[model samples]
Structure formats: C-alpha cells, structure tokens
Target: MTKQPSSLTSIASIVASMTAVAIGNGMMLAYVPFALTRSDAPDWVPGAAVTMIAFGGLVGCVIAGPMIRRVGHARAFSCSMALVILSALAIALGMHPLVWVLARGLYGASGNTNFIIAQSWLNHASANHWRGKAMALFYMAYVIGLGTGAWLFGQIPADGNLPPLVTIFFTALALLPIGLTRLPTPPAPAKVSIDIPMVWRNSPVAFIGVLAAGGLSMVVQGFTPIYAAANNVSQGDVANLMFVMQFGLIAIQYPMGTLSDRIDRRLVLIGTCLLILVAGFLALSATFSNLILLMLVFALFAGAVETVYSIANAHANDRTDPADFVPLASTMLVAWSAAATVVPLMVTVLMPVFGPRTFIYAAMAVAALYALFVLARLRKRDEVPAAERESFELKSAQMPNAGALVEAEARAE
Candidate 1:
C-alpha cells in the first residue's frame, strides 16, 4: 500500500475545523429569524438581517485572499473563529436591533473568511489527482455540519441568551482542532484581475446560473424559517424543516457531481433549474398542514437549488482556459454575493404584497430565467468534448476556496 500525502492528512484536520464552525453558523442562520419573530419584531426585520449577513460575506470574500496571504491559513482561520465568538457574545448580551444587525454582519464576514481559509488550504494541499474527490468530501462534511446545527438548534430554546451562547460554545470549540494541527502553510496566491464582462462573455449561462442560485438560496435557507413561522408552523417543525432541507443538500452533492462528470453539465444545470421551478410552485400551493409532504417538497427543493453552484461552476470552467480559473471564480463569487445581498430585501418588500409565500414566487421566477438562459446557451455553442473537460467538483458559495485549488491543479497539469 502507498503512503498518503501529508497534505491530505492536513486537509482532514481542516475539514474537522470547518465542520465545527459551520454547525454554529447554520444554527445562527435559522435561530436568529425564529428568535426575532418570537419577539414580535416586524416581518421585514428577519429578511433585512439575512441581507446584512450576505453584505458582510461580500466584504469578507474581497479581503480573504489578501488576509490569508498575510496571516497564513491557520492563523487567519483562528482569528475568524475568535471574531465569531465575539459576535455571538454580543447577541447574547441582548443588544438593540441596530447592534444586532452589526453583530450579524460581523458574524457573516468572519464566517466567510474562515470558509475561504479552509477551502484554499485544502485545495492548496491536496494532490491534483485527488482534488475533485477531496472537494466533494469537504462539501459533504459542510452540509452535514449545517444539518446537525439546524437539528440541534431545534432541540434548544431560541429565546433569551441561550441561542447565542450555544453558538459561542461551538465556535470556540472549532478553534481547538486548528490549534493542534501542524500543517505547512500554503504559498500565497498570485493577485488576479477580476473582469466581470470577460467572465460573462465566456459563459453567460454559468453567470446567470450562479446569480439565480444565489437569489434562490437566500430565500430557501435564510428566509424559509420566517415564512414557516408566519404560516403558524411550530418552532420545532421549522427547525426540523431546515434540517430536512439541509439533508437534501448533503445527499445530492456527490451524485450530481458524478452525473455532471459523465454528461454535459449544461443538461444537468437545466434539469436542476426545472426541478427548482416545480418544487417552488408545489411548495407554494401545498397546504402547510401536511407536514410530511411539505418536508418532502422542501427536500427536493434544497437538493436541486443547492447543486446549482457546483454545476454552474463546472460549466464555466469548461468554457474558459485553465489560467483564467482563479479570476473567473473570484468574479462569480462576487456576483453571487451581490445577488444574495439584494434578494432578501426584495423578499421583505414582496412579503407585504404576496405575504409569506413571496419567496416561493421569487424562486419560481429566477428558476425560469435561469432555464431560459441555459437553453439559449445550448443553441449558441457546442458542448465541450468530455475528453477536454475537467472533472466536476462540488462547490458552495459559502466556500470560495476552489479557485485557488483550480490554479494549483492547472500549474500541476
């Protein structure tokens, strides 16, 4: 038997750390909305809070590359975890609405930074042959952590300081594995110029897929809890729903990635968009009283929408040169973040006119637009030959480290 690479060993440690922090982040994402609604805060407040987090994510993604170069991955990750702890403490102390918004934004930035560090580190460390499989494993671990967090939050009280304190405990625990791991620092990334126009010109389908996915994801993951609460679903059920949705997300990553590897990724992307449209409409029309059926619908919805980032990313890479991977990925991340930041606010506005179901309509609309774009692209360009295509790798907008890994693999090849 051959000995495994030391970089692979280090990646395992980083995965553990990432999973821990993701659990806390996932719990907070659902808990905040549920808690605020319980407090009789206005309908728009929850969606606004979610938007703040996405805005902070944009900031984090912008600075993360430079920060990682300066501090090294382990130290940068630790600093982000520490910031998360501080943000949780702020919420625990019962700050005012404005303060809570600021704290949530801080949480988003720190959490995004941590994700970037872990992803970049893993990609930097893993051998080229193992990159796709390694990233799939990382994505699976992340989804599991998120699902576990949602389920755990359901078991605890959302009122008072308990929720934030739990978040702090988990976040603090995430730091332990990082401190213990003795890993080599990755080489600093070369600075790349982001050209959004070039990226779109290269693959309009991919650009729109990511943008639509971002908008749909914020509604599904960020606003769904509030929607459930508004519809008279019990807090326990809301948590369970979130866990089910995350479970769908976790269950689909490897299968979708494997399928994309075997076929034209455009076909897979179009299928996913159709799935989102159907699921969104069904979810909107279904009576909330049928808990089991609703859970199933949401599971399908999450599974499909969550796979968009990976599929779209794979499609984009298929169309571009290997040298362009880093810049292309960076541009897409920014675009996705911008869409996520704005979509929730739109939800806030539409909720008054469309009620709690506005997010569903929003999901349907985006899915339709994305499907149209994918069809148009098919007519305009021939598919990339499978022999020339890169292996499909799973990715999440929350984890923007794949770009660095793509550049590393390109250099190796």
Candidate 2:
C-alpha cells in the first residue's frame, strides 16, 4: 500500500475494494431478507443458513492473510468472486437449504478478504496523519455496498427461485471492474511472528471501542432481517431496514472525524458509545409494529458504533510511530474481523430466548460495557497538562485558527 504509485492505482484500489464489498455485502443484505419472506423457506431456516455461512466466513478470515501472501491478492480475490458468483447461480436455480448454506459460506469466507486487503493497501499509501480520513473512506465503502445492495434487493423477484438469480447477476456485476482494471497486484502485509500484547495499554479506549463496534455491527447485520420478518414486514421493508442502517453508516463519519480532530478522539468515542447505549435501549423496547421508529433509533446507533472504530484507529495512531502503523493496523483489522465473526453466533443463540430482537439488547449491553471501560481508562488521560493535551489533538487543528487574521482585517476594513 505504501508504494506511492499513480493516482489510477489509488482509484483502482478504492473502486475494486468498494465493488468487492458491494457484491459481497450484497449477499449479506439480500441473503437473510430473501430467506425471510420467501414462500418456500421456514423462519428458523433463514437463521440456520446464515449462521453456517457466518461460521464459514469466520474460518475464511483465519486463512486469508497467508493465502493472499502465497497466491497474491488479485488471484485470491478473483477466485473468491468466481466462487461466490457460481454459488449464487446454483442457489438461484433451486431451493436447497444445503446449497444456500454452501453459497453463503463460500460467499462469507471469500467475501471479506478483498475488502480487508484493500484497506491494508489503502493504509499503506496514506500518511499516518491522514490515515483516519483514509480509513473512514475505506470502511465507508462497505456501508455503501450494503446501502446499494438494499436498494437493489427489491429488483430480485419475490418468487421462490428468482431472488437468487438476481443476486447471482448483481454478484457478477460487482466483479466486472476487477476483470477490467489493469492494476498491479497489491502487496500483502509482513508476517508478524509476535502477537504483541499491551499494544493498547495507553489507549484502551481504542481497543475496546473497535471490538464493540465490530460486535454491534455483526449482530445487527446477521439478524436484522429476522427481526423485521417476525414483525410481519415485507421483503422490501426488510431491505429498507438494512438500508436504514447503511444510511446511518454514511451519515456519521465526517462529523465524528471532525470532532475527533478537534477534541479528544477518546471522548468522541465514548460519546458515541453512549449514543449506542441509548439506541440499544430504544431499539430493544420497541414492539413489532414500530419499524420506522426502530429504524431511526438503530440508525443513530449505527452512526455511533460503526464509525467510532475510525476514531479508535486515530487514537491508536496517536501512541505509535509511523513504521508500526501498518502492522498494528493489520492486527487491529484482524481483531475487528474476528469479533465480527463471533458476535453473530453468540447473539443468534439468544434469539430463541429473547425473541428476534436479541441484537438490540446485546449491542446495548456490549456498548455500555465498553463505554464504561473506556471512560475509566480515560480518567488517567484527563490529568495531562493542557499543553500536552493539545499535542495529541488531530494534526488538522494546527492550521491557522479558522481564519484568525480575518477578524483583525475586518476591523481595519
């Protein structure tokens, strides 16, 4: 990623990354929603199929790093696309539960690597100071993919087998850019011999913030379709419910990034977690009929937890040197992916006990727990001198203080 190649290289990387995620996430947004409202499938079957796919996805992340290194990213990523597209076509032709599991698992396992590696590539090109913005853009691509998929979700017919065929076609649509681009194969991260401990000792806020963000996002994504379905909503409404979450995803990052730049990223992070706390409460309290209100509440929650990981990234950058950023970033990305895998499995089991709204309660509880720890860790940081405090502020603040001389010139004028 640090190769400093042509702007087309950068553009290609971003486009490839975003497109891969859009199609990969297209499966995510569409899979459960389709299964939920389909005339042929039962309710629990959707959850069962998704849980297996997610588990396969979890296993996929473990091997992706080494696989990317061994075979190179382009081939690795392209193979994943082929597998996913083929699987979608198979599912489209028929309605076998086992094939649904296989398609989705292949989709999950292969889907996240391209997106993950793309971020690593983007991180390589970005300066540490601007990395927060860069990472925000990278992560936003996933949300945008999800957003686009939800809108596209309706184009799939509501009949027994048609939706899978639509999914297969769009899945192929997302692969075209990669096939056309003349981009060089991006380099993989260096293999880490050590699983460095206490890396977040100075910035516990960042450590927990990211994990919690991953947890909340995975839970909602894995199960929101189930929640909407049990409430008697249509497939389109389920798509829109996921879209509302993506809407939250796109709407929150810039302001949060700006606030992190201005004040302590830690506080911005904590404040966002608190927002999730409120959102979780509101989200859990609602009955089946209140879909619109639930959408608004979860959207607010999405803004808080989803984008806060970028702030956590900024905070992590604060304590490390330029050289360590890439390795640390790879580690953090792994950590987040690992949590994203586990969160759904744990929460899905809760659905039978707590009803389909398990994601809400679980997200709220996790957010509150992480928020409290972050605040506690931040207490020591609060005692730092005012001068020292500003030193850790985002580098963007050192510019002329929002047009300082303009006021004096206005008086002269």
Candidate 3:
C-alpha cells in the first residue's frame, strides 16, 4: 500500500504552494505590466507583449504534470522561481516591449508549472476524507495571493525598479521551504494514451467552465487595475475593493467547495454561475464612485464562487477516474489557455467604446449567457437519476498519461 501523506506535509505544501502562487501573482501584476507600460512600445504593443508571456503560461499549464514527473516537483518549482527572480530583475531594468513580453512570458511559465506540480502533489497527498476541504485550502491561498498582489501594486511603484527587485527577493525567499522539506516522492502515474474526444465527452461543462472562468477572470485581472484608474474610482478604493473581493473568495471557497462535494456537481456548478452573474450585475452598476456600493458590489461579485480555475479542476477531478487526475487537469488547463488568449483581445476591443470598465461589463454579460446555458443543461438533465450519475473520487491508484507529457519524454529520450 502506498503510504498516505501526513497532514504536516499537507500543511507545509500548502504554505509552499501558497508562496509560489502568491509570488507568481505578484510577479504578473507587478513586473510584467510595469515593464510593458514603461516600455517605449506603442499603446497596442503592450497588449501583445503581455499576451506573449501569458500564452506561454498557458502552454506551461498544459505540460505541467509530465514536466513535474520528469524533473520532479521541487526541481521544477525551484527552476521556475529562479526564472521568476531573473524576470523580476529584468523588469526592474525596464526592457524593450518585445523583450519585456518575452521575459514576462518566461517568468509566467514558472508560476504555471509550480501550481500544476503543487496541485499534483496535493491530489496525491489528500486522504479521501479531507480532499474537498484540502482543495479549498489550496484555492484559498491563491485567492489571498491574488488580492494581495493587487493591493501590493498600489503599495509598490508600478514603473520603478525597486518593486521588481524587492518582489523578486521575496519570491526567491519562497524557495527555502520546499528545499527544506523532507517529503517523500509520489508514485509514478499510469501511462495512458490521450483521447481528445474522450476528455471532452467526460467534462464538457467543466471544459466550458474553464472558458468562462479563465476568460472572465483574466478580463478582470489584466484590466481591472487599468479600469479602476480610468474610472473615477480612487487607487486606494480600487485596492480595497480587490482586497474585500479576495477576502470574500477566502470566506467562500471551503464552504462552497465542500458544498459542491456533497450535492450533485451540476447544482454546484449552476450555483457558481449564478454567483458570477450577480457579480456581473453588481459591477455593471458600479460605474459610480460610491465607495460603499463599489465595495459592496465587488464583495458580492467576488464571493459566492471562485470556480474560475479551481472549479474546473475540481469538476474534472469529479468526473475522472482517480488515475486520470494529472492528465485531466492538463486537459482542463487548455480550456484556460484558449479563453485567456481570446478574452483579452475581445476586452481590448471593447475598451475604445465602453472605456476600461468594459472588461467587467463584458465578463458579466458573457457569464450571464454561460450561466443560462449551464442552467439549461441542468434542467435538461434534472430527470437523470443521482445513482446513475458518475461521481469521481479525486485520487487515483495511478496517474493518467498525458499525451503531451509523453511526447516531451519521448523527445528527451
């Protein structure tokens, strides 16, 4: 029998995982955009430049598990952190737009690999009893990190070299815990052939959820700061708004995750969609600088669900065999990548017409339709018997073989 991971490992991993994600968020919000804005590039140049890096990140997510398996998590994560530090130093010096974009993309991959590897570790480490709660905790750290990053942007000078060097220093510091930990190695995952049709068949909604979550969330993340500034919303208020929103995500993730674990996953999914819709409407009305109302809307919008990334992972986990977790997660991440690529371009187009707040409005409008579609699916499937529904156990006896991962290994061979 495989020895189950201790809670100590779980806790320590969570912290280390949290550090990776936090610093990753920090780097993205802090370094990349700063470099882009500070570059001698034209207005449109920064967008493409930022996308260049983010697109690579999406690629990293797709290949994360196999990379981890081949290189091992610690090594992969360490390398990523080191790259992030280097990227930070580069951003502090303020490179050319294309160079900044390339560096950001390279830096972005570090976070992607770190997250995927950490998640693979978490999936293997979890006992069935605490799986949902544990996943919730994993998500909570990410939530905190995202909110903290936005707030830190306000605290740190966006165009200055100091924030990059300083944030990089802190990110480098995050490597210590993982290095010091004496965690045992995870079991080798099973090697299965890839079936694109099979993954789509198993988790279509989850796949779409990946789109809604990634597209909407990216629209929010990449543009919200710019949006707030464009609007009359003060910088302090914007930071506070994000802070409250993250805190709301923190408040809700565990309960919502556990709630999903209990009920039919569809209902849980619908609930998530509804939350986004409400958030959308609230944000749409948030054109006013009414501080209370803005924060309230942000809080509502942020709370009730945070499934953007985590839910798809959970849903994929739910529908998949335990052995398929890593591979399936990789498949779901592609959905994130596809959405990330498209949404920014879409929102950027909207900016000239609706101003910067257009991203949030666009997010809400998209989510409303998505929620409706999901609701339709739920209603159509309502007659299906619960027992007939396949519920997944997140853990598998062995891991699924990701095709891309195998190809990479074959190339290495």
The per-residue C-alpha lDDT of model 3 at residue 196 equals 52
lDDT of 2: 0.60
State the number of backbone clashes in model 2.
Answer: 1
- Candidate 3 residues lying further than 4 Å off, grouped into runs, are 9-14, 20-24, 27-41, 45-50, 62-66, 126-128, 187-194, 232-235, 252-268, 308-318, 323-326, 379-413
Model 1, span 3-25: residue lDDT tens: 33554454778888878887888
Quote model 3's TM-score.
Answer: 0.80
TM-score, one value per model: 0.94, 0.81, 0.80
Local distance difference test, each candidate: 0.78, 0.60, 0.58
| lDDT tens per residue, model 3, 1-413 | 35656564455754664555574464456345434444455555555544555576676755565666677767877777787777767666765666666776776576566665665556566665665556556655666666676577566655556667766767866788777766655544334344556667767667777667666656655665455544545545566666666666545555666666667666676776677777777777766547777766666555543554454556655565655544565565666666766877777666667765677777777677777776776754432244543333222100111122322221121
lDDT of 1: 0.78
> Candidate 2 has which clashing residue pairs, if any?
1-124
RMSD from true fold, candidate 3: 5.5
Candidate 2: where are CA atoms >4 Å away? 1-3, 8-10, 13-17, 20-24, 33-45, 48-54, 121-138, 192-198, 287-290, 382-413
Clashes of each: 0, 1, 6
Candidate scoring better on TM-score of 1 and 2: 1
Clashing pairs in 3: 53-105, 189-399, 190-399, 322-395, 322-396, 323-396
For model 2, give the 10-residue run with minimal summed lDDT.
396-405
